[model samples]
Target: MSSSIWSSLPFVAIWSVGYWAVHVPHLLFLSLRNTIKPLRPVPQWSYRLSMGTAVLRAVFRYIGALRYQQPLQLTPGRSGDRFVRIAPPADANLFRGVFGAPSAMAKPAPVSAVWSPAPVVAPSSSHPSDGRRRKVVIYAAGGAFVTGFDPEMSSRFTSALVTSEHFGATNLLFVQYRLATRADPFPGGVLDLFTAYQHVLGLGVAPADIVLIGDSAGGNLVLALLRRRAGLLALGRNNSRSGGQDRALAHQPVRHHGRAGSVLGVDAYRPKGKALTQEEEGYISPMDHPFRLETPLYIEAGGAEGLLESIVTFAGQMADVKGNRVQFHITEDMPHDFFVAYPFIGAKKESCEALKRAKLFLEG
Candidate 1:
């Protein structure tokens, strides 16, 4: 080989190794963390093979490469990330006497990522004032029900939220729920989500001070949670939203879809298994629930995403039912999860505006 070519080969080899080290492990960990069990459990060897393939894909990102377009600029926050296990009240008892209670409590499914804002450099940029209740945002990520949670996406988004002048939130918790698979599908993931919500509440944050945010399937979970809360309150009021019951239950949660099922041959895009009935699917929807909520809800969606139709329908129905309590921001021509791309895409202006509105909603 020529001298020039030989000299340049080392740099190429070093770059390749660096990329492999960072990205391959990420894909592998994700595959393992969100394992798919078809019937009972995925066979050990098959699981390994599946993860190996995923890691390999990460290592070689482009087997059939397409010509690259202009890169989008994303201003991800410098927020610190931490992992913690959240357990139900009963589960907390199991760790009471354990030497490694924290570790033991963390072993269960549905790990969470906590992102703390960067230290304030400017006095004017400090956290919310003492008079104002510090906002605590519990974010759920969107990935059509089948895909598992994305921590990087969640962290990046949270970082943006807390660092930006719009939100200036101090505490952000991103829940990583079990993804839908053959063994753990549909409502199974929803249960884990409920536990996550309970865990947050257990931390003593008032339901009124909490802001629930979700995209795609995560959006589905958020709606489900509010619905459940509304249902509970309604039951206490004799399931009536009229007369004395309405006045008495005014403080209860007022409840408030997305797409990809088309490719899967199922309407809900549920995990690979049996299909769900319209009523069963509707049960998971946030639109069906009716009640009033003290907490404000902020929803962001791209107009171009597959789930736009369902999302628009849900937003419209909820807005009519709950009035100003539900806020919806739709960005034309944008795809799913546009907030994560706030710094780069042409649609970022709308995304940023949506967040600003969300901030205002929270302040009120």
Candidate 2:
């Protein structure tokens, strides 16, 4: 609720409480009805979640918070691993990693002297993956790009992943990429992810040992980064003249609530108020131009998700790629990002099963 209000008007949060208080009972009633007569199999609390999320979506889209970069507290929770802040990769490593060294590379972002330091979630110290430990999960948090590290869902979901012996991840790096609302969209998040990946490499973790994990919009960025790493899409300065790598860096959404929630999400892919062109839409959607890639992937989607059909089709394309390992899982009864609410009341067994599947996929 306060997330949508401007910092200057802190009173709005106080005053808005009365309005929410009045509606609580009504919302609960609706939530109850949803559970009794669910449109599809979902957790009992999911009804309340949907109601709350609808309001949250409106708050972010209507309150205009999406236009600015709000403060972020990158807490690592009780995992005993702190978030490690590292300097952005030098021009040589980032540029040369995705594409051959350029004669001159543009600074994608302002230098540290001019901007705040790069913030990344610290890899697990207790189970550091530096050769001795092995694999690490680079977690990209889902908040529709408006919210960073959604306190509600991310904590529950991530905690389960890290604690589970099934997942067997000793280290996890949660990337604190800039949000679209901060006036950084498209390549901004990907660029930060690339730096995080390289930073982990510098830590002596093997590339094969790294597992990219994300949900919702964060999941999309993970998918894009996978392609970027595989040399399908380059994440660098947008150069319209060059194709594949150079020209490719230029974004195309080429491209969202329940009904309205979907709309709010689409806007996050571009600058505020700016509409997406056809090619730009394509850039954000990996399914649009599915191609061959050797990078292994695990894709999960709800059978009830509007994007389920498309997600399945995309995974099929990836599976067809020669020697590419793909594990696709569908929880037919849950909604999109249902795992975020994880092991909650109604979805406990289902959610745990999903995580177990992910662990097996990664290990195998």
Candidate 3:
């Protein structure tokens, strides 16, 4: 071998070791988590190919954390572009427990940043009621339910959504949800999502008019929320079909923390299931909760993501159910969270195509 090739052997060896160091544990952890067969089986080749993208994402995330370290902090007393709108008090309990440190680290309140287009108002037709024309997008960040929200990341995504042709200049709420670990567990993140959804509804935006967009874990939350919504709607429909007696019973008023659970009936989406595995994870399957309704859902996934299997299966499940206006796109060769990184990276063609599809979905 050449002298240079021999000299570079140490570097190559170290790189290979580091690559496996990062990937092996992650893949193994996923394996352990899926001892009870995942909703969709992830093939071996797919896992191997996705590791490259995962490594790239990790490198970018670590570098970006150091670069945009200040904006990533959720400290208090900050105003202007740095501040976040807090969540309501009713949902504050969702962050309690052992893994609550992440939530408490923030301003002792649930908060999120809002983005709206500047210098232009969306068309009047966008808003369904009150003659005030506006479009609302409630977005959640994806970090495998372990990493908390990043301000800079949310800002980039919200910007892409707002500037898109289909969504012109619109109102966007970037929700910050609690992350789960072994200490925290599941459903806490899902509960935070429910709170965020309710917060958006409280902001006077109709549920039908609001669009839910999330990526990866955030996408999972969107699916879960849609499932819950579907369940509630189906329950309501079934009740109505069964002689309208239930609607009268629902009106009889049951108190929940001092307010009726629902004016009409029980909202199945209100986080009833106590166990995380049964309530949240179980409903993630589209076969169980295919969001078969008129809600306009736009889901974008990278063709090269580790989560692609589950995302594709969930999307396919929804597709198979019929009655859903769902626009699903897999940006070929892209990795997870490509939308946020597109500006920093130079995959303008693929990224732009994904965003274009998003715009078309919204416009349609």
All candidates' TM-scores? 0.57, 0.69, 0.58
Could you tell me how far off, in angstroms, the CA of residue 243 lies in candidate 2 after the best superposition?
24
Model 3 lDDT tens row, 219-319: 66666555555555554533321111100000000111122211111122233334334343344333344646545566677665545676666666666
The sequence of per-residue lDDT tens digits that candidate 1 reaches over residues 92-147 is 42222211133221233544444444221112344343454445666665544544
Kindly list the per-residue Cα lDDT of model 2 for residues 1-364, writing each as its tens digit. 2355555465566656655675566556656566664541345436645555444444544444334334454444442335455566665544443222231121244211000112223367664433355556666666665556543245445655554665666655566776664244565666676677667666655566667777777776776676665552344433321121100110001113223544544565554554545433434666656644435566777666666766777778767777767778787656566655454324556656776787666555
Candidate 2 lands at a TM-score of 0.69
Question: Candidate 2, residue 300: CA error in Å?
Answer: 0.9
All candidates in order of lDDT, best leading: 2, 3, 1
Clashes of 3: 0
Clashing pairs in 1: 254-291, 254-292, 256-286, 256-287
Best by TM-score: 2
Predictions ranked by TM-score, top down?
A: 2, 3, 1
lDDT of all the models against the reference?
Answer: 0.48, 0.53, 0.49
